[model samples]
Target: MPENFAYPVGLRLQGRRVVVLGAGQVAQRRLPALIAAGADILLVSPSATPSVEAMADAGELRWERRRYRSGDFEGAWYALITTDDPEANAAASAEAEARRVWCVRSDDADAASAWTPATGRSEGVTVAVLTGQDPRRSAAVRDAVVEGLRDGSLAAPHRRSRTPGVALVGGGPGDPDLITVRGRRLLAEADVVIADRLGPRDLLDELPPHVEVIDAAKIPYGRFMAQEAINNALIEHARAGKAVVRLKGGDPFVFGRGMEEAQALAEAGIACTVVPGISSSISVPGAAGIPVTHRGVAHEFTVVSGHVAPEDPASLVDWSALARLRGTLVLLMAVEKIGRIAEALMAHGRDAGTPVAVVQEGTTAAQRRVDATLGTVAETVAAEGVRPPAVIVIGDVVAVGA
Candidate 1:
């Protein structure tokens, strides 16, 4: 862990040869960031996407327009391969490592020299989210966390101590870079941190090496610590005159049982505060470039959980009304119930052919999305191999592509 490390610090790449092996949209996404950071790009691809061609024509990059060669990475400081071919990406990583040049493998996590966080730049401050495990997930959380700060919902940590209250912070969907500047600042100054199982671990690396972190997150179908015990631990730590942070995955207040912990702290006469983080309901799809609302396509958007207990009546959403509503429907943790959700919506009069987009690890470098009509979305997702912690956006607006 490192404290107060200045990030977004520009690395001088003015005269460096940086090879990018891919000309698809994924490769294009990395170009702007690298170029902005002053890397002289050498793009190697047999074919180029429109975006890549534009950059090459503008002299921002030198194009080879061919398959990779053994000497492709000669004298390169960094190499990035965003091709769909995992073998090529792996080969590039292996070669770069052997040459002692850093490489970022687009498709494999274990093969990257530098992981890209989902980042937002403002007024010279760059905020990035890292999962420490999944760079792509970090991207999603990063988007939501930045949104939380920009929307004026969270504040940076101050030196006040006497009445220091507990703030249950949400780190956003999955991106570690998504944590707020205020949140990151708070993390830097925190005396103790009690984090959730779903929160990104890369954020932990930003803390001072001396800071104490307690993993108090719950696990499903396991011998897990009770919530009451966790709440008690938070209060006890804060009462000892320490600035405590209870970190969650998405918006802490959403489904993280934050209110219960807040209530418990209040009952103990301990100071408490709240820092809102990004919620998957909106930011997840947005990261996948799917807007939840559009002028004529969707007038409203709704989000609901699909993981509540069977006995919880509130978990049962009004499918009939949702189907008839002229708006976007975003489902969190609904991958397991895709068939049921589609059936309910269709049975309740929603068009079977309504557009749908399933986004996994949205907004991160590893983001993957599958676009299909409602009638085919489930099958498409399965065929495309989309996984959990995903969002399903259903409506006419799914037809839009970035």
Candidate 2:
């Protein structure tokens, strides 16, 4: 088939059988979309890549675990043939043609009855680009179009109904680029944005002059806007037909009090969209060359809030249980109370000499790492003048990541 002769069309595969002849890279890459389309996929291959096998184990598709045979496409509405063997590919292609099923052949595009396009999505729009057999070109085009759509550079005309609601978006661990595309898009479309002191502070500068940028001023343990005041503000603006965006640092659900805002919206009969951000609990340690979990060294990791001292009645953390576990412990908002927390951990059976790394302002240009142990972390932090918005990693995985 020539490039000019290929006709593009969308296939609805819901409740339909789609046959995949191989489980290699091509199949692994294409299976997710098929599964998401609600296809009853039949993957016929001797083996599969680890990711494809995981999808099968998760019951996303049925794996035959055998070589393709005649009539494999007995009831298939579509076939994706990617076997390395030319003979098998030809046979499957023949079967698909005879069955009148649409087929995409990875080995040879000229011989294939159909071609796969480079696909991408932004919001509710799906962008599919096809430039003959030039997949890289198609992918590049798709990326450009999707990025434009996400950033509102190629804004769609006002054809769809405008939805006014509160969006609780996690700004990701202090990097403007780390914020999700949806989160960025929401910011672009926001009529009003209520921002936090932490998270990605640089993105606020990008908002247009018309967009009201409210400083929530939620400095940890400092003078700040009350939670009720913040909730009332979100409601007041949204009720007046304004598109409100509540932007916070890290994950909105991860100690960001996002759910509280969501619940308030629900009570007021306002819709809310929660966009999850990369939590600093995991990302901060990772950005600081510390793997929260390392194979054999640490199998599990725990993230704890150290905002309050363990000895405080308001604290609910099981310090003894956490100390007993031989795994990585990630502490957020704990810089102020780290001394007491360290003492509690050591007193509750955690090793005094356990490796610890305190990552300050992770993923930003100002990011820095301080290394010590459970026994000396407090003294090291005090001596170094470490501040809030730092992640404290404790356990042997700290050494492994280092």
Candidate 3:
């Protein structure tokens, strides 16, 4: 540890209270980082842009919908001043200091007691780049450096985990381009990659030949490997001091069974991290030129798994409420149950003529799409031979271009 390093450990702001005085792009860029850090945010903006407003509506943030005031810093552990008004930022900075809370000024670094650093994390490894001039620039440089170091040895070795460390990453839908920058970097650095068969194979091909590749890929139901065996292999590889990546098709936490793996790792004393990815539940339909939500065609979108266990309570989705949602319904892994799902929706009051589209191999060069109404979608999809790893989108928006 460097002697000059006063705050050595980066602030783990998970569940911490943070207040942002602005609702602009600066705040937007920083919002994702804060949310990922687990911060409970309070955004104060007299006027919020569409994205910010959407986030507030989605419950990702608590919007005050008012001008920033000195009292906004009263109980905040940390505050960010991201407004274009320099004078307002200056006042917020002073208020933050009076409350003994740390604050960062978007335009005035000199007034900041401490500045945020450019940060990147790999299995138990965190690298913070400080340029002493611009943290944003430093962050960009850090991202590039992290990209370059994906396959190289770390500048410093990480503490050896006795139980080993594993990373469960979502490779995103099928587009190699849709994978998060972090997910791509981790893939390059991973010593071993255990990927689902449904995940994009092109991504796995990007790895160096020396990287061990194991095919743990599973299909919905016809035939697949046991989940327990997959978990054991991840543990075994990590305990061997090799970085293991359990890559999945979409956002690991979103119906990807990533939590189950993470829980197992924790019980075994192994360290793990989850990197979010674009899910086919939304991205696939989008690539096929279908908007999940529109001004009036649809106002909400519900993502449900088509792989629910027959005995599972969730298997009985509230189809009546779903039909009344005035939004789009997207089903993942539901191709096999297409007829049943459509029947349920129709029984619950959904219009038989509701437009539906099945997108297969979405986001890939070999993409296939089939458009039909709810009444005939099951038969249409079956005849079209659309397979697993496809998304079913049902709503009027699917007929927008029809």
Which structure among the candidates has the greatest TM-score?
A: 2
The global C-alpha lDDT for each of the candidates, from Candidate 1 onward, is 0.78, 0.91, 0.82
lDDT per residue as tens, model 3, 308-387? 63334777677668877778899888888888888878888899999899998899998989989999998999788888
Writing each residue's lDDT as its tens digit, candidate 1 over 1-402 gives 653222343356777889999999888888998888778789999998898899999998999988887778889998888888777777778889889987777687566776666788643456876666665677778777765555323444444454555778888877887876556656666788898877767788767767789888542324435787788888888888888888888888887898999999999998877878888778888888788888877889888776642234655677778889988888888887787778778888999989888888775677888888888877887888888878889987787654
Q: TM-scores for all candidates?
A: 0.57, 0.80, 0.62
Candidate 1 positional error at 358, Å: 1.2
- The candidates, ranked best first by TM-score, are 2, 3, 1
Q: What does candidate 3 score on TM?
A: 0.62
What candidate 1 gets wrong by more than 4 Å, as runs, is 1-164, 218-225, 308-314
Scored against the true structure, residue 281 in model 1 reaches a CA lDDT of 79
Candidate 1, run of 10 with poorest lDDT: 2-11
Measured over all alpha carbons after superposition, the RMSD of each candidate to the real structure, in angstroms, is: 16.3, 4.3, 9.2
